[model samples]
Target: MSSLLDVEVKETIDQKTFLTFDLDKETFAVEVEKVVEIQELTNITPIPNAPKHMAGVQNLRGKILPLIDTKVKFGLDPIKETVDTCIVVIEMEVEGEKTLVGTLVDAVQEVVTVPSAEIQSSPSIDAKFDLDFVSGMFKKGDKFIMLLNLDKTFALDEGDAADNKENQSHAKSKKS
Candidate 1:
């Protein structure tokens, strides 16, 4: 029988680095190359007429960056900020434009190198998350980490007038 370390080494020969983070106690990873930086929770200014999943925008350096609540995007409960909460800055192509966005995660975990052979295709099932966003899955010890296809996962489309109006109204209510 092959030892666990041997199996990992064999599988990790052609590995790619990924930055792992926690969301609702689940571990998810994104390619390290796509990640710009990781920051602690910062004040987010609400935006009018934005989508529900949009947490708002924040000033990163001098540039404004749109923030997405990963929990809300996944249809999970909003995160209660703690010391571990962080914002993961990522760059991706959105609507043919390169965009920098911050993703709110429960906690930022360590960077891991996962081998291509270790990744398995995501199963199509009645999962809480849209399986389309999952590129693959791999095991780290006994825990499985879902690899996210950032482009597909963070794709945001222009909203219709009614939806924009509704979001605008919701934002107004929150300010009161």
Candidate 2:
């Protein structure tokens, strides 16, 4: 048999396992290592000056993190009070730094381990929702769990990003 050592074969891929959650009828997931904790649905303090998708702030063990509605981010209908809603707190790394961010979902399913071999780059999805936030897709059993690139999902535009950078820098200085 002829040897086949192509570039794709020579390169190794880095994959992190993730936990799946449901929104509307679709299933999705984010890196498990990035996830801090999944909290039950609770009162979130609305922020008067926050962005449209931001549900508001929440205090977890004395640490504050912005709670973002996945429905809002995906342009879904407004969420009504339900028994299954929850907040999946994820720690994301953006621009070479890490911070905690919580995402509200319709319901959270059990965690499913996805192997690196099972992941593939996602293609252009229909424009109904922004697909740029999706890093890839992984299949387990008969389900497809869209892997969210949290960094890209939380990517802020110039002004807001600049404000975040300033805040981060100040925080860094205080720490040092």
Candidate 3:
């Protein structure tokens, strides 16, 4: 009886739930623990002098949430807005601070429990864009879902931020 109990506990530990979503032609998954909530695509106020990858900011239940274009971040062209388009609110640790950011995706699919044994290492492909964000992948039927490393995928470099700030200040000074 003890051995059976041990097997059950181990099996539970070995499976992880992931929230899968579509980004263009590829499907990606992120651990559900990091996901906060999903919001339908709404009016996003554009930020002045922001990076190209930043879609803008949205009011998520009175809290301001920064929206990021996942397609542009991955070096893919932005997808047209449709009824299925939505924002995936994720909690990511950036520079030791927990920040809530919304990522725009083509669509959100069902949540799936994937076993650890089925996950494979990221493939070494000569792709146009960097695959450093992908931690692992697993096959589900005919399609494979790439597991994303949240920290790396949504990393904000301090240098880039500082530069942008400096440029903005300089522009303001020039206008004055």
Candidate 4:
């Protein structure tokens, strides 16, 4: 029974549907299983002393969801909201806790099923952008979509550090 269950789990992991989206005109994908839902751009309350990448927080069905600007996180210019702009709500484990984070994308594309076999390891290069956030690359026709490791891409420790620095700055300012 255990062996059968293992095989089933392996099969499930071998191929997964990914939610594709556009960031800075480039295609990117995140595993669909992590996606909670997609939402239209709405009013987000600015968080005091939050990181620059953090767009702010939104009230989602009574829960405050933190929003991350994907373009800013990727070290690109912040996106100018358009009709196509939307948020992809994703649930990820942060510091062993399940957290829901909204990722702001330029636009969302259709979901696509990609086999794990087809994903090629991202090449290590000395680029301005951090490649650790990328899990792999998927080729579709003439374009290659970057597969993002959502967990690593939005690590809570980085946010915490940013918050701490902001708080320290605020405290120093108040003292003056």
Candidate 5:
């Protein structure tokens, strides 16, 4: 009885769980082990002179957690916050320290269990944003969900993000 239930729960030996979210119509996922929690969109204190991709900071319990706009970070246009908009709090390693950052997503999908063999390397293709942050991907139904490398995607280098945006703008101007 009890043993049977335990065996059923332990069936995912070769499977990993991921927390999925949506931005625009594309889907993205991160390992559930890296996700701390999810919260509905809350009042965010805007930071002065912060990078455009940064949404600002929010109070998580008693700690101040910085928030990043996932769409903006991926070079996608930011959409107005709706009822489905929420924050996915993820634990990332930064400068040898463990830190928590809240990422804003259009909507959270659900936890999905994927077999290890199903995950594939992302193909090199022209995309709106750099695919370096995508660690892997897997096709589901008619859509492919990219798995994000939390550390790379949410690196807390404010100056580097601003510099990258500036450099991209310069390149675009030069092309004109």
Candidate 6:
């Protein structure tokens, strides 16, 4: 699979690789360029001082990689992961460098090709989950799959996480 050199910042492309998956009974698609590799659920090594959304790191073919639980990022209750859960390894171009990140999906459906014309801009969403993370919506049959901006979804940096922890800790300390 070839990495689309500029999918992170630019959204003006025609054909796109859609990796569809189920999230809370809804289907979502992340650009295929964002996906490094899809693998069956594997053991994750927890890292201290890591972001809360971070599920931990996993070893894929001897590579240590970070795993982010999308549920946590979206402010939803964490789903009890089962054997069916698989990690979708994503490689994103962040700040001019390609970084690898993984998100655990309930189940991966398939990789389908959809032209850019079929993707429609995000409509106003009234949920706590940020709609900006969604690039567009694609319809298949009576169902619609939200095409996700994986890079934007899992794009938190260490500095941002540290600042968040500081704020959280300050808020906690004041509660005492």
Clashes of each: 0, 0, 0, 0, 0, 0
* Segments of candidate 3 deviating more than 4 angstroms: 158-176
lDDT string for model 1 (40-105, tens) is 888899876777778899999999999988888787888889999999999998768888999999
Of candidates 6 and 2, the better by lDDT? 6
Over 1-176, each residue of candidate 5 has an lDDT whose tens digit, in order, gives 57976876676687889999998888999999999999989889987556777788998888999998988888889756999999999998888989999999999999999887899998889987669879999888888999997877888566666766786787788889
When sorted by lDDT, best at the front, the candidate numbers are 4, 3, 1, 5, 6, 2
Candidate 3 lDDT tens digits, 62-101:
9899998988878889767999999999998777888899
In model 6, which residue pairs have backbone atoms overlapping below 3 Å? none
Candidate 4 residue spans exceeding 4 A from truth: 1-13, 158-175
Scored by TM-score, the top model is: 3
Distance from true location, Cα of 10 in model 6, Å: 21
lDDT of 2 by residue, 1-176 (tens): 43466544544334456789988788888878888898888879987545557788988889788888877777787566588998999887767888888889888887766558779888886855578778889887888778887876776656455655666677788889
| Candidate 5 positional error at 94, Å | 0.7
Which residue pairs in candidate 1 collide? none
Least lDDT summed over 10 consecutive residues: which range in candidate 3? 155-164
Residue 58, candidate 2: alpha-carbon lDDT: 89
Model 4 is weakest, by summed lDDT over 10 consecutive residues, at 155-164
lDDT of 3 at 131: 83
lDDT score of residue 116 within candidate 4 = 83
In candidate 4, position 36 carries an lDDT of 98
TM-score quality measure for candidate 4: 0.85
Better of 4 and 6 by TM-score: 4
TM-score of every model? 0.83, 0.77, 0.87, 0.85, 0.83, 0.79
Q: Which ten residues in a row have the lowest lDDT in candidate 6?
A: 6-15
